[model samples]
Target: MAATSRPKLLAGRKVLLLADFQFEDLELMYPKMRLEEEGAEVSVMGAHPAGIKYTGKYGYPVKSDLCVDNMSTTDAVASYDALLIPGGFAPDYMRRNQAMLDLTVAMADAGRVVASICHGPWMLCSARRTDGSPLAKGIRATCFSACKDDLINAGAQRWWTASSCRAGGPFITARTPADLTPFLHAIIDEMAK
Candidate 1:
């Protein structure tokens, strides 16, 4: 007898996830596995030393498959179909890495889906366009309340939605872990495009 197979809506899609210490575990894991389940290739990259495990804010530890120290932003942007930034205090540390910032912008410019949740939008606030403007400028999205001002200062408008917000272009965002399921759905929808 033949078995049924789930539809691979995201087949051939590649998603790049940025990670660091204190990342929101659910925000990272949900998307990673969901995307994979839908047939997308997901790669985890972190700023920590190669092979070291980074702990999330809730004490969940996940090892990164790639180290940011040796990462090539250009190669990364060209290689992936989308980029994801998981929220937590990890964005506090990720925002300090120039390569991660560059890759975030490049991916957006390349017409790839760029999704962020909770405090993850912090990384987006730090990214810049080729013309030196803020990447988040003019994007309409919702994020954790604490990061609201940063996004506003970056020229983004507030979107008061409980679920994940999927704006046109390469932007998708959510407010917190409670929005994870919807956020994952948004990413899949965007990549399927």
Candidate 2:
């Protein structure tokens, strides 16, 4: 008997997962499962090539798929249909990486869907757009309130606070992991569009 291959809903759609330090475990896992459930190919990318273990706020370790260094931002951003930035301390770590920021900027500029939750929007904030503006400027978005405050204080114009909100362009933002259901749904919908 031959083994059957997994069905591919996102047969040609590739997704890039960016993580580092800590990220809400459930937030990352649920979307990965949902996307894969619909046949999207998901690849995890982080700072280390050996794979970084995701820890919760409490420091409990979680598994990762691949390392960011192993994959080039030029390649992943260009090849993938969308990019998923999970929130937590991980976004803080991602913000410091130039390659990650560039890839995010490229994905958004290319009109590909860029979905984020919790603190994930920080990476978006780091990517300076062509107009010398934050990628999220003038775009309605939501993230961990703590991070939202930082964006607002930093002069990120047009940011609005909400439990969950999807804003201008192909961006979806959620306040926390609890807000992931709608966030994931929006991402799938955007991919379909």
Candidate 3:
């Protein structure tokens, strides 16, 4: 009747990559590659069925590993140790999907780490889980600075403004693609714990 514990680091962790039409290419691929290098299994999730072709903000094409519709929400995402949301227009698209939001909420509630880059945190805001709540209320996290400012200037509330802010919960947000290395490291570290 004793509880079993998860492994340290991502020796055998499963990471869910969620995206839409246009996502930061480097931000998505780099972390996915890095996590795989560390013995983690990486899978792609998109709004389309046949699979989503990712485009950079500048319009360069990026290929995906799989489609969201190809796998069941309860199957593809349910067992992952973490969720990675790369920014760009993708998170915006993802925000509209109830299934994606539910998966994110479930991960955070389970105390699993959720890593996001660039405007990726926008999905967090859409999930309504970034409102200084117990899940991500004040954790030292960060996200794309200009985007955060734009949200504020546009009168949007519930966005993180710092370059790197952690809200004292399970969320980890970073400002840009340049923050990927550290952000992925942090996520790996958290999952390892």
List ranges where model 1 is wrong by over 4 Å: 1-3, 160-163
Q: Write the per-residue lDDT of candidate 3 for residues 20-49, one digit (tens) a residue.
A: 777888888888888887778887777676
| lDDT digits (tens) for residues 9-98 of candidate 1 | 999888888899989989888888899999999888988776788889899888888877787878887788999999999998999998
Output the number of the TM-score-best candidate: 1
Q: Could you give me the TM-score of model 3 versus the true structure?
A: 0.76
Tens digit of lDDT per residue, candidate 2, span 48-133?
76555766665656566776656666676678999899887888888898778878888888888898888888877887777778
What lDDT does model 2 reach?
A: 0.77
All models: lDDT? 0.85, 0.77, 0.71
RMSD in Å for candidate 3, one decimal? Answer: 7.0
TM-score of each candidate? 0.93, 0.84, 0.76
Ranking by TM-score: 1, 2, 3
**Per-residue error (Å), model 1, residue 63:** 0.8
Top of the candidates by lDDT: 1
